[model samples]
Target: MYRYLEQRLAVRIMEFLRQRYPETALPAVVIEQPPKVALGDFAIPLFPFAKPLRSAPLKIAESIRSEIGSIEGIAEFRVAPPGYLNVRIDRAWLALAQALARDHVPKEEATSGKILVEHTSINPNKAAHIGHLRNAVLGDTFVRLLRYAGREVDVQNYIDNTGVQVADVVVGFTHLVKKSRPEIDVLAREPRFDYYCWDLYARVSQWYAQDKQNLQARSETLHAIEAGNNETAAVAETIASAVLRRHLETMERLDIEYDFLPRESEILHLHFWDAAFTKLKSAGVLTYENDGKNKGCWVMRRAGTGKSEGQQAEQALVQESGGERVLEEEDQKVIVRSNGTVGYVGKDIAYHMWKFGLLGQDFGYRKFYRYPNQHECWISAIEGEKHHPHFGGVAEVYNVIDARQSEAQSTVIEALRELGHNEAADHYTHFSYEMVALTPRCAAELGYALSEEDKTRPYVEVSGRKGFGVKADDLIDQLIVSAKSEVDSRHPELGDEERRSIARQIAVGALRYFMLKYTKQSVIAFDFKDALSFEGETGPYAQYAVVRANGIFNKAALDADEFARNVANKIPAEEFSQFLNGEATDEIWELWLSSSKTSYVVNQCIATTEPAYLAKHAFQLAQLFNAFYHRHPILSEPNEKRKQFLLATVAVVRRELTRTLAVMGITVPPVM
Candidate 1:
């Protein structure tokens, strides 16, 4: 919100400089937080102009500091070591922050355009694992944060309902178990159907190992499913749809909800891919290579321009001629196989084109799942619901998947470029994070006792086929049980039902925060012991700091409103020592510094597509608040007014911390 004030000051400075120097253009100015509370609240690094300012940077800084006094909301200004301008805000100005925050009842606005975040697109045949949690949590956080920043977001969980995984599951049931829909539905009504399928899917993989001919059954099943007209296809759909519901229920437990469910089967059935293929061909991007690779299929001349073939080719050319330079060639990605069918890259390119409204077509939608006739989920196809609201027309799109898909993602970008939809391509973003692996303790707890060879690697890999990782529900169950016991211990007055609710909050918070705390690229080798901590860079600790802060506010008989009135309260520059006290107030000052840096974290996250920045800030905010909590005797302070101001500050910080965690997809426990 203060960005407006910063903008105004910058304009005035630029105008003032322009009047004085007619020949020189006004330079870029940065408005930033000062290093210390004693310093000016905002600072500008003039060293960027050490050459322009002419005199040494410090003298120039002092001159600028003197000139800067013309601005209001500024008290005294000083130059820090190595020539940084330290501008202290008038304490009275900070008091206005409370009012500004009050007047600003931030409405969570819809995103500027539709944001269809495709995440948790897990294979239908396997059980949901901890690796899936990372994708869903990060993707969901993006939806939350973007909405908070006033963006309309639509959360979508892509289901590979007709992929190889589901086909394998179909083979397992129809061929292996010889079970029909009613039998499978009965099995689904039982507990852990996903877990059962998880084992069955792995066993089915092994079943193929017994005989090479058995693979034909899988291939035929896949063809029949894709063709969408046979009993086998019907069975595959039933299994795939059921598994998807199971996955959604798992996500719902963690407070994740979605607007739509996009099935790959629908994408194929709707002829959206055919429409996309038509455009690509008309645009001369996709070629019908009837002769190339000795094929009957269509293909894309790899986007690479042949120079990327490698230096050996270039060296060979040089040896033949010795006088010219050859550039690296780029490789072509295949669109259609030589067998006259689409490849993974081809379907993905088509899906991406459709995502950005670049493809001249639309999917029909029907009422998705209706929960007790109140909650409705949407399904898309060629002739589904004809009057549903627009789904595509996204100003921005984020696909949250693993880093392994970077090359595949690039192909989508290339498709957009080839179609001349450069703006849409620019808006397309890949939110890639390293995979979540198992720490030794977590692995051992999950019944994956590692060999010495496994220990040699930095982290244990999570393999779906191996079925050797923590299931999301299993992890949540453990955390809830652990947390419920703590709740009962701390609050002996509470009933079992109330304690269960509290435990759910704590458990979900801990899991979501742990997943989000690192930058997306940082591989989380999650340790059970570390994940279970209630203090120090943990979710419960964040809640603990807030509760402690709230306790101080309550003791002073203050609430969010009353405390907000003092955000701009004046600091007595003369009584700096009394305020600092080399105690908790000092800790408060450090927390203040970190809390103020939240805007920077947010800006970086927006630019880099990294959710970990928010996670790291949440941890830092909690750590600082905890230190402040231990050092200050809040209600017992001698100066009532200063204590009131301190309590007010705590209220604001606590509100902010709780809000930050929510954006990270971690709900704060009500009584932590």
Candidate 2:
């Protein structure tokens, strides 16, 4: 309702302004909420138009207030101090419309084409850690927000099967563990293969530190895997595919789903990089560096440096420091090393080109994994099934990568622009976010041996190479155990299976909400106690509110939908208006007002590319509903009309809260 009225009023005021001042160029009309509800529902400032109209802001506000006769949902317009125009909504009309679940907002026009979201592109080498969870949850929730806002979206999880990370694991099995291809294949088929690899990867890192010569094995293994059709490549594939499956299963515990899994091996086997290389060379996007440490390598200017600008800067450096000091100026990124192996950024550029449908080549698709609901997740292949869903060719693409990859992501976008795919470059979005760290208490609870210095720090950063991080599956299992104990102590009457199911819901909710409650730029310090707490701003708290709302209907033996129908049919608009306008019922009206802003809050979240806003909205809504729940008694009240009105309030709060949590990928269990 707030969004609808805001949009309506903005359009009406804009049209009025253009007619009033025909020669003046008008600015965008922005609608904001007043600080206090008593002031008005919407606030618009006329300061922006003062210079254009050659009039004082106060005079402009008065002119708008007097001439802008009436807006549909607005009851009165007042000229506040300075240049503000405040609008009071028709409270009774809004209350009645909301009670009936009637939305007067017009449908938004659909975006031009499909939006491809790439996230959770973890290296297929080890078990996913807490850092990976933050990436996946943020990406998954953003996808949900886009879908909720009526956009066509495709979710992708890129598999780096041929990267150095996988090569290290391959080295660990072959060299450190002395396992053959057959032995590794057998081990990959066993349970907890990713966990085994996790430890082996850490061992390999230590092995390299012991002797620098041991690093040669990693290079050789990486080359063999990229060349494919060999024993080493087969072993890498077996391990990567198995670990990738484990990753999907872990994410599935949180109800995260993907539509495609594009593998790097397929990118090599299908000649994606080769095709992209041809385009880059033809467009002069790549240059051969003949000297100064990058001899024999093909390079490109870094993201913000254009070709001419780079040349001018290098010339200036040469003039200032002479030719001998030129080696110190490192302004170019090597696309192909002197050894002729393509860098990660090169392949990433090719992959992004494919994402935007600019790469004429396509990948072969085959079904790789299936969820319990039978939603098949497809993967790229050399020779795939004949009939498969089209995977690429999107109008826009968003890569949910970590902030550390900002440079590489920017290079990809710059390459697109240089190649003259300007529109595609403009639509490219790098959803960068900071990493997650464990609080000292959380690290201690995970049984890690923390040094005294580490314990005193605010957060303890985990290193995958050191095998010092909490695995995703391990964390999920622990959360479920904690939640189950809480459930057992509180609801012993429920059966074991039912209690376990509810516990799973609560655990997943807590984990996902903890991941999403912070802004993308804010680093999350994961703590088990804070996430599971039921009294404060946590997922279980919101879940408990929904549960309590449900209990109200359960005890009264009344259907929530039927109660809403009763309010809409039995109560008069004037009576609801009087009830809503009464000073004694301000808190009740505030609950309804908060409930009405779910869509408004969703739009805010989408516009900002941040799910934290929605998380805050859900928490605030829960707080308001809890306050209303305690202050007003529904079933025990003797006033029939007031009781029904109260029930109607509960029904709306329950529905909106449930929907909001679902958008964050959090579920409200029947017994939280």
The CA lDDT of each predicted structure is 0.73, 0.88
Candidate 1, residue 327: the lDDT equals 23
> Using lDDT as the measure, which candidate wins?
2
Q: Can you list the residue pairs that collide in candidate 2?
A: none
Model 1 alpha-carbon miss at residue 369, Å = 3.8
Error of 1 at 119 (Å): 1.7
Q: After aligning candidate 2 to the native by TM-score, how far in Å is the CA of 2 from where it should be?
A: 1.9
Top candidate, metric TM-score = 2
My TM-score estimates for the predictions, one after another, are 0.89, 0.95
Q: Could you give candidate 2's per-residue lDDT for residues 1-672 as a string of tens digits? A: 778888889999999999999899988997888887777778998889889999988888888889989777688888998789888888778888888877654655454689999999999999999899999999999999988778899999999999899999999998999998888888988878999999999999999999999999999999899999999998999999999999999999999999999999888888888999999999999998777788988898888655477877877877777773353336688999888878889999899889988889899999999999999999999999999999888998988999989998899999999999999999999999998888999889879999999999999888898898889998899889999999999999999999999999999888888899899999778776676565578888899999999999989998876777567887788878877885677677777888888888888887778889998989988999989888877899998887777788898888889989999999988876
